[model samples]
Target: MQPRSPNTAVKFAHQVKHWRLAEDIRAFCAAARQSGAATDWTQWAENYAAAIDSLAAPLGMPPDPPAGQHDLRDYFRGDTYAHPWPFDKDGQWILADDGVDG
Candidate 1:
């Protein structure tokens, strides 16, 4: 089988990080709402996207697939493990929150 391109690997890593953050934000928003805190979807989406971009930028990755391309879901659907590793399993790709992997 052909090896995945560097761009494709970078995109895959970015997608993984992006979705992880999005899920965290969604959970936080839900908890905040339950506790009567204000929640703004518009601002949240913007901030979330920006945060994802910031996290991805240092890796020299591109932004999420443009709207002109296939849908985001379509772009991600495949054997993602085929992508190359940006960092080794023991290497620090992301800092841990609780002083473990960080």
Candidate 2:
């Protein structure tokens, strides 16, 4: 089942901001990795099919949660089981933590 419908009031205006989209992608990928969904061909195929269907339609799937509405940190918590990724106090995703002076 679809988890939830995205906000449509912002249809004329952009809803998901760039930073949030990037973080969401990262989190989704991380969950897939931890859940072994990355290697699951069946799931991949299903997702691919759905994407294709969306592309074929004049209008694709509705936009997901906007920048402030959804948090990447919480989206995949259950699927990933463990949160290896780090986020700053402000809840922004951290790319890396190299112990080096730049």
Candidate 3:
């Protein structure tokens, strides 16, 4: 099999990063609303994580942690909340980096 191109690899990495961030944000939001050790910071962290994913995805890549992980914490280690891109973004339909968004 042929080795994946640099562009392809980058794209995959980006996607993974993006997804991870989203997961973190979602978790943070949940924790903030709930009462417990979790606090507002938790929510911010999650949002930042999600933002990273969003930014990376546009470059043709997967979200961090490769999606379906236990939680965003395992996926990313950051200080700022990463916002996810709107569903209408081109990256949303990126099936592959074949020059087509889908």
Candidate 4:
């Protein structure tokens, strides 16, 4: 087989790093849910956002990117099946409807 191009190698490395980062974020979210760590959904979202930002820092990513760049908050609000968190009128933590049925 022909040797891989330098650009191809770089892209592969980036892809691997991205995949690992996604897994780490998934695990963090899972553990956070299991732990009942934070009672406030927004606070939990902010904390998770910070955690992900720090995780991406070593990869040369900005914690909060410039305007027009993808904001980490969008990740939490994305179309993915991951349930959104919200507090009810009684202030009890709850999983907000994501508009997608199980």
Q: Rank by lDDT, descending?
A: 1, 3, 4, 2
Question: What lDDT would each prediction earn against the true structure?
Answer: 0.56, 0.50, 0.55, 0.53
Could you tell me which residue pairs clash in candidate 2?
none
Model 2 clashing-pair count? 0
Residue by residue across 1-102, what tens digits does model 1's lDDT show?
A: 432455566766767878677767767766777778755774576477567753545554454332321233366656545644333345435333434553
Clash count list over all predictions: 0, 0, 30, 0
Maximum-lDDT candidate: 1
Q: What is the Cα-based lDDT of residue 72 in candidate 1?
A: 33
Top-scoring candidate (TM-score): 1
Instruction: Give the winner by lDDT: 2 or 4.
Output: 4
lDDT of 4 by residue, 1-102 (tens): 532445555655665666676666666776776787644673565456556443455554223212221233464546433544454445455566634597
Better of 3 and 4 by lDDT: 3
TM-score for candidate 3, please give it.
0.35
Reference-based TM-score of each model: 0.38, 0.24, 0.35, 0.36
**If both were scored by TM-score, which would come out higher, candidate 1 or candidate 4?**
1
Indicate the TM-score of model 4.
0.36
Mind sharing the TM-score for model 2?
0.24
Task: Report the lDDT tens digits of candidate 3 across residue range 33-96.
Answer: 6756567677667657756765544443333332222234455655324643222343343333
Give RMSD to native, each candidate: 16.5, 19.9, 19.3, 20.7
